[model samples]
Target chain A: MTHLVVVGASLAGLRAVEAVRRDGFDGEVTLVGAEEHLPYDRPPLSKEYLAAEECPDPRYREEETFAGDLDVALLLGTPASALDTAGRTIAVGDRTLSWDGLVIATGAHARTLPGTEHLEGVHTVRTLDDAVALRAALRGGARRLTVVGAGFIGSEVGAVGRKLGLEVTILEALETPLARAVGERMGRALTHLHRRHGTEVRTGVAVEEVLSSDGRVTGVRLGDGTEVDTDVLVVGIGASPATDWLDGSGLTIDDGVVADETLAAADGVYVAGDVARWPNALFSDVAGGTMRLEHWTSAADQGGRAARHAVDPAAAKPYETVPYFWSDWYDGRVQFVGIAPEGADEQIEVVAGDDAQGGPFTAIYRAGDRIVGALAVDMPAEVMKYRRLIGGRKTWADALELAEQRRVQRAQKQAAKERGEGA
Target chain B: MRINVDWDRCTGMGMCESLAPDVFEVDDDGSLILHTEEISADQEGEVREAVAACPTEALSLDGPIDA
Candidate 1:
């Protein structure tokens, strides 16, 4: 029997094993995870998991599904220490497991503030344990919350802190927060969303040092010799791909485990999730280069696609997608689709709604003549439509036409609602 | 199969609509619109794929319903 060993029992790892069985691979499968808990959703960790009075169980499925239905051996809480790709063996703690097919879905680790690893009030939300601890700190009489980075995670955490009635402050080194993901214009608008709430946002400032007293975090020292006092400090700087175990495994590694369009990192080995850096065929012509998406949707999609290619190489096709991700802050949702263009010929415009107001709006990103990406503020259905256009490599004109159609639709809906009220 | 969405958990991520557009749609107001709750046998594979793709774990497939 073909025994497939899937490393990382998170979202990608769980989907990888499921895909293997779904594709009629009756092979013996062993799933190894660093955490003891079965596969659970991670997005909620920074949002709902942190805000809720009682923590919610976010497991994708129960324990019985993996053990009984999937018929796979579970090795939880034991992280893979090393990989011998030539011999097809993986070292997990003290045990060495051999496999015919391998799926590396190890994912990424949250980048914490240097020298604050042992600090009492410092936290990063990458795992369930991390979220639980952060939630406790937030609820445990934390009067002031300071987030080092103004990224999605930091923004969400800061938003939650405000909801919990804590004084919140966000520090970002970039001139404009979320500029890389949503362009300068939209990023500035999003930064306003934080200020609209009671949260204080300071841009173009770096945390020079983390200050602590009695082994607990007290505040942060800014680059310009200024200090911000805080009871809880969240380092949402970002993450580094967990590729330390594959140091000499011969798989090409840059920012992440480099893979081809097929997601094959090596012979009989596939990579998926946040760790897999592969060229998405959808933007092959856009010159966006190889991409690594940290979105939950991409993780699950790439996991299943990589597993199927591993099982049957002959039936493999190049994996392609219009990458998508959504972040919830306060009462609004921020969604982005496809890769945003950089440098010259890049155009970003508010296609629908008013960008001036801190309300619902849709912005489309363009490169040359084609629509490359879109950022939506509380505009969900409209954004997905643009995603389809991006996937089809539609022109800028096409995007404009679609935007007009949506505007008309919205107007008609509003008019009908008004007519009903008048009657 | 009967498609069920936990309205409480569904944040209109549109993963289901992306996988099986015919069965599901996210409206202008950002809420999921189930075109048909009772899906046919032929639609089972893609419907299952849609159910699996939901990030929020909101979508569920129930019954090969009794004829």
Candidate 2:
């Protein structure tokens, strides 16, 4: 019987196991996770999970989904400390387990900021326990809070902290929060969303030092000679792939695990999620090079694709799909699709919405005639519409009319709602 | 194949329409507008992908003609 060993029993690892079974692979499957608890969703840890003191369950699927429903064994708590890729064996403490096929779905870890190594009240939200700890600190009546990095995690954390009645301040090193993902114009719109949520936004500011009192984080000193005081500090700096175990294992490791478009890491070894930085076809379909997406949806989709390729490498299709993600700040939602054109963004961006009142508009990115990327605030449908346009490689100049029509329709609907006429 | 969408469960995320544009369409405010009730064979795969890809798990697939 073929034995499949999967490391990092996360969204990617769990879904990879399910994919293997769904593909009719009657093999002995084992999942190794570092965390002691069952597989839980991570996206909510910064949103709904932090919205209230008592929250809904964060587990992706019920235990029944893994118990009798799937033919797999769960090995939680112990991580794969070492791997002999050539020998097809992974060392988990004293146990030496070999596999017919291996998967490296270890995901990524939160990057820690300097000078906060042993400071109390400094936290990151990468795991369920981290969320619990942060929530506990906030619920314990921590008045003032400061968040580093205005990325999705930082933005969401700031929003949730305000919901918990904490005075929150978000600091971003870049001029705009999400410049890399949504470009500067759209990022400014998103920044307004955070500011509208009662969270103070500071940009182009670097936290040079973590001010502590008796080994507890008191605040952060900015590079621009500004000092922000806080009782609790949440670090959303970002994350790097959990590739420490694969050191000297002979697999190519760049920023993350470098893989081909097919998501194959090595011969029988495949990778998924934040760890696997494969050249994506969604972005490269129009342009030429590779891209990596760390969103939850991308991980789930790519995990399944990676497993199928691992099972039947010859019959597998290259993973090709539009990358998408959503971030809910206060009452407004920001949905983005595809990759934004790097460097010269102004020449390619054709925006169609106003950034007023938390920005309920859509901005489309184009490369030549075809659409490349899109960012919509409170315009989920437009994100979807543009995603199809980008996927279909449809010309954006042609769809601008439809975009205009939708804008008028939305304005009418909003007017009706304001006049107490529409639902 | 027959396509079904649970609006109560749909958060108007637009995963379906964006993924399988031929079958489903969403409005500017993320309201659903069914374009095609019966999915073509070629689009079945894409529709199923959309259904699976829905974050809320609000989409389901049913098919193979009752006859």
**How accurate locally is residue A140 in candidate 1, as Cα lDDT from 0 to 100?**
95
Which 10-residue span in candidate 1 chain A carries the lowest summed lDDT?
A340-349
Local distance difference test, candidate 2: 0.81
Candidate 2 at A132: error in angstroms?
A: 0.7
Q: Score the docking of each candidate (DockQ).
A: 0.51, 0.52
Identify the runs in model 2 with alpha carbons over 4 angstroms from their true place: A285-287, A348-351, A356-358, A408-423, B1-9, B31-43, B62-67
Q: Cα deviation in Å at residue A50, candidate 1?
A: 0.9
lDDT of 1 by residue, A1-423 (tens): 388889999999999999878667888899999899999999999998899978888888789999888988899998899889899999999999998888899999999877999999999989999998999999999999999899999999999999999999999999988888777778888988899998999999989999989998999999999999999999998999999999889999999999999999998889999999999988878766899989998899889888888777777789998888999999789988888777522488788877766558888888878898988888888787887788888999999999999889989989999999999
Docking class for model 1 is: medium
TM-score of each: 0.96, 0.91
Cα error, residue A4 of model 2, in Å, equals 1.9
* Sliding window of 10 residues with minimal summed lDDT for model 1 chain B: B58-67
